[model samples]
Target: MFTEEPSYDVLKTENAFLRARVQELERALEACVPRESAEEQHHVPYRKIFDALPVSLGVYRRDGLSVAMNTTSLELIGGIGDEIIGKFNILEDPSSISAGFVENFQRAAALGKNVTMPPCAYETAGSTLATIDERTVWTETTYVPIKGDAGIEFLVECNIDVTERQKTQKALEEKHALLQALIDNAPMSIFANNLEDRTILVNQRCADAMRLPPEAILGKTPRDLLPEDRAEEYLREDRQVLEKGSGIEWESERVRDGKPYHILMTKFPLRETNGKVYGVCGISMDITQRRRAEADNRRLQEEIIRMQEESLRALSTPLIPIAEGVVVMPLIGSVNGTRAQQVMEALLEGVSRHRASIAILDVTGVTFVDRQVADALIRAAQAVSLLGSNVVLTGVRPEMARTLVEIGADLHGIVVHSTLQSAIQYALMY
Candidate 1:
């Protein structure tokens, strides 16, 4: 298996630590086995450090005879190394050559120095190295060439297990790729800025919105990409979001493809695992069509309101020229303050336009007579009188007469007729 290079310093530190601990153990072992046989002393090297090491280790000759392995090495290989350590020869073993581990060992011996190998996974097959797992065992190994006056001597193979770390790294990489894909394919413009207000991430829509490539936008501040005024507005919003640790929504306008667009923007703070607000993220949606539709609707609504007002004005004070020097205005529905004012203006204008001696206000269609309605009638009549026109009130219902009197409406100068026919005859005669 091929993997990223392991740290060189870590391997060297492991070797140095092992050597120091081995020296201490070798002193103690030498004291215990004094006056032993040459054969017994010959086995001293492996016995000196096997019990003291926590790392998997093996001592191999340059020609590739495995001299010894520690207790940890036996445990690392799933308790199978004890049987093979003294018997296996890596340079001659078909499995070792096939696994290509022999090349690294031979390289270390030729250089007469230590070499740190990249991480590798080994199968627990009929190979010289047996590791316990239903899956391949991942490890990083460093080969140290021990030299003597006779030239290169033994090779120390140190192995560090990295199965769990490799799995964690792979999982994180997959998740990152998934997240990137999601953002890149999103419809709305999405972006994130770091603490320095530099663009850290921008999705496909964001790049397209700016009419720039992703590489052109990344790592650049808004000022670099947009006009100063617009960039400052964006920066200010970002600063506020980061400071408040909250979100804000607002509408703004921009031009794209030579056309103006209204966009609704939402900006929020991005938090780290520790709950610290590290940056701001934003998404902008183009609402150009919606804004245009709303504007059109407003214009339509205003036109409708204007048309209704004109119709009401016409109905409120309809001036009919019954004959020369006569005009009749029919007051229908309820008369409010605004309609009353219109009534007075219409009557005076009608009197002048027809050169009439009298103006008749027919209240036959009036639904109810209140103090306000009576007052409006009185005020309108008084105003028309000033224009040298007499306002003759027709359709004077008994209830309206009571209301007019109770409200103290002074109708001294104005003529009151019970019917429009009588009012018209009276106006022509006057």
Candidate 2:
């Protein structure tokens, strides 16, 4: 019992030694364990940030298994822990949200960079549940990578429903195609030009008529297709139309390939919404056939005139004697210059032919007489008298007498009577 009395000092010494050894080991272990630096401590809060994001946020390991996800991500995937943990594959379907998505994630991890493909098509069981019809579900997806203390991590994806927008765009494209078809097939030659007088658009008819492709004529002015002189005229007219902001109709002759064409052109000043004239629009009609017809008609008219004059001259020639008796030429219809000349010629010829003692000019069938008729009658009488025959005129109306007297026609050598009966009686006396 007396020997154990020295135990307090020994116990104290042993306790001190144990304390020192424990302190040295704690320092060694502390140096080997590698404590988190300030940067790592700062990034500790990033996990909360990723989990609290509104968009579907996810952190995937390089092995294609989802390591973590936010609430929205979990909701989008239908579940978080066992649902999409490691069972999901990436290459089965390019359109599958869980399928090709892993491939994109792996690519980002490999490059240690961010990659974005144009909104890719994606499908998933979770998205399928949201779809009304099982046939189709359209979504646009995006993938991102996050770099932190855990090294580069892949984001699963966030999908946005774009079915309506895609459908609208497709419908618009279809409508545009249909409208272009109508414009191309239109009957009339529709066209448009820019302010610089360059052709911007032309339909098939216009291109065909110009003997050029629609593309070939683009950016070309009328001057390029028209002759220099004609181009100048067209430019002047177009300028006037633009200045006046009005419409004009013009007829012009165009020669193409050594052939002439008559064109009826109507031009209108093209205007903007503000009513400012920018250029001119025109429509042309080929009137070559009409012009040819008119020319032919003119030629025929001249020919008819020439023929009538020749006939009048032939009738005006004096006739030779056929018998020793009177020759009768009964005047018919309204006698004008030509007809009257014929009658005079026939009368003189008859007088010469018969060597008749008397010549009677009958006008019973004549409707009305003019100064020309009276002149022709006087000429006939004078001619007959010169031939040594007594000339008598018959069937003279009062109006005819007045007209002849007013015209001062020399009818003194001619014997005039109101009826053919009187002339015949007078001739018998001769």
Candidate 3:
């Protein structure tokens, strides 16, 4: 992390204000002027505090020739106050010339208007002088005009070091630029709006979604980009998020590029440190493809279910007519409770529909019979007999006979035949 700027540079505030009020110094202007001897200057009115002030201060004639230097100024110039006093001229200083003081000299120094110059490095430190500080002093200098009888008589010079403050401000600008880059490159649409319903922030993705650039999108309301109905709906949702001070999510449909898309949107309140809602933030993602895939999967599942039911129906009760009063029921696959029930229904229905005297069930293709299958067969025979028909079972396998015997199935009135043809012949003879 970057180091924070120190509060040292702020001392110049008081120095600049009090140092420039030359009217107070005007009372002692005659006395404060530098004399031939240094010992007598201390006795001048307001001389003690003015020299002891913490900032760099100097007095110069309207033409910019140095007249006097404060205690701080003497320390910065090094060696002795008598050495550079009245010799240094601000108009000839390299930093001041580059700062346009040479061009604007009269209006600033000779006139009554005070002017504060931009921050610049001063070479009066250890560069040429024998001062203690080895580094260059960066300072903001101010020239205040002191007025008297005919016109402006003198100018008061004040300087404040501002090196750290300058660096801190530049550092903050760099951090803001870096954060802006990251937000612009994000994939999803992100935006925020103030309580006035004006857009305060928007990512590049959101701007592109609205078919506008970031600058065009910001400071605009929902109605600026959308139809009246849609805009009102969006604003209403934003208000809800702010009122609730919580997040909400839902799916909505939006049209883009002449096609409808599903958007998964979420809105939340942006709060201050005091927990007051200031604005609303929103995030949205396109989910049209995902929604389409889910719908396709549901259709496929329904189709598969229909196909399975058809296959089970075809497998359960397959029937064929053999003669005018006889029908044949062919059984196949392993029998379950549901399929067994279908078999019984088919047999009774066929006997009544055909006015058949016999319903022959061919179990040649049947797998091993369980108790459920055995019970289904007996019930079918009894039902057919009640419908004025006789039940004949043909082609019983050895396993089928053994299972029926083991289960002690009671098929007392049902007739048995060797094959489907023989059962049909017997029914014809009857």
* TM-score of each model, paired residue for residue: 0.56, 0.49, 0.57
Full-model lDDT for every candidate:
0.85, 0.71, 0.81
Which 10 successive residues of model 2 have the least lDDT summed? 315-324
Candidate order by TM-score, decreasing, is 3, 1, 2
Q: Residue by residue across 269-320, what tens digits does model 2's lDDT show?
A: 8878998877777777778899999999999999999998767555444343
User: For this target, which candidate reaches the highest TM-score against the unseen true structure?
Assistant: 3
Q: List the residue pairs that clash in candidate 1.
A: none
**Among all candidates shown, the one with the greatest lDDT:** 1
Candidate 2 C-alpha error for residue 87, in Å: 8.0
> Candidate 1, after superposition: displacement of residue 49 in Å?
5.2
222 Cα displacement, candidate 2 (Å): 6.6
Candidate 2 vs. true structure, TM-score? 0.49
